[model samples]
Target: MEKAKAFLDKLTEEEHERVSRLPFKNDFKFYEDFALLGMHVDLVKPGLVSCSFKVPPRLTDGNGNLASGAIANLVDEVGAAVIYVEGLPMNVSVDMSMSYLSTAKLHDELEITSRLLGRKGGYSGTLVLIKNKTTGEVIAEGRHSLFGKPASKM
Candidate 1:
């Protein structure tokens, strides 16, 4: 909780107000409070999701480019959101891989599209593409495999 408090302490007045207004408070607190990903879920369907957010300065690397870890966090969280929409039980990531094609600078508007590849008895695969919203340039691609607990088990 110290980290969350410390991060909150550094937020500008406007940013603090924006964070305070987040609807899904408990659900995305880590991403919003720590990762500083201003995520907004635009659409969600059974097997697909579309999200958009800006890369906050706090998420950038020393060179002022979006950090790889931040990109991975977005990919992972967005994929999990897709799984949740598909009526799957809570899941754990079994495997994940990312391919970086381009870079996004701090505050870049990013569009993330995630699609579920297929679901087997206990596992599902997902693919995601992250692109620059204005230029439509692909920045990264990600693949994730998740293992879901059975509804009965849950």
Candidate 2:
């Protein structure tokens, strides 16, 4: 609570502006439903980042179950946000793989955590895990490979 607020407050003005420029930042519907679901960002370092999000109804699929695509998108967004937050040039997802470990029903809050794994040349990799908030059950996992390049290249 207090610690989280302090961390957010500690961000430099430039960093704050960069994050605010994120595509989803101005989306009220996204914020009201999906983005506000226990989202947190921890900047580990340049080219390194960690982020998590709690699953919510808006992120569920037609069956009222956690949507795999939505989980993948969340992981992708967080991973990219890390690079953007570092004031580095933009990067694009070159490849991504998501594996569902379990199903989350409506109203079941789950946390998805992502971390940078490694990088080589113009390629960066990340690993993400989604877990049930209360039971610590793994609901899904993802691996992402991104192509690093200047923002102008995008």
Candidate 3:
């Protein structure tokens, strides 16, 4: 328990520093950390979140393309934003999968579109597409499944 508490304290400190360095803040404080990666939420409707992000050099793979993990992170985070905007309980991701269609090189401006596919009971499904804004080339696509807490817990 002591170790876990120490770890949480360290994580919180790191997140605080990261948030302080953000160029812009968003309505979601937890998601605001992504701003350091140059991600901006262009729209957030009931079950959708449209975002614009630039592939920074630091997030590149060995081949100088956007990292798959980075894309997956974007997908997962945006999907969570979609759920949050829907007045649902903050959920835990049960599964997430991504398919790489093409490569996005450093400095590429990518558009990320995420929408909640559906919500049944306490479960939610979401999909995200990452594409090059100029060419409409798909960079990656992903799906996420999450289970929200019961309403009584919210």
Which numbered prediction scores highest in lDDT against the true structure? 1
Per-residue lDDT for 63-153 in model 3, tens only?
9998888887888788777877335457989999999999999888999999889988778899999999989999999999989864544
User: To one decimal, what is the Cα RMSD in angstroms of model 1 from the true structure?
Assistant: 5.6
- TM of each candidate vs. truth: 0.76, 0.64, 0.74
Shift in Å, residue 58, candidate 2: 2.1
Which residue pairs clash in candidate 2? Answer: none
Give the Å shift of residue 21 in candidate 3.
Answer: 9.3
lDDT of 3: 0.82
Better of 1 and 3 by lDDT: 1
Q: Rank by lDDT, descending?
A: 1, 3, 2
Residue runs of model 3 more than 4 Å from their true location after superposition: 1-36, 85-89, 152-154
Q: Return the top candidate by TM-score.
A: 1
| Candidate no. 2 TM-score | 0.64
Query: Alpha carbon lDDT of residue 148, candidate 1?
Result: 78
Q: What C-alpha lDDT values do all the predictions have?
A: 0.84, 0.71, 0.82
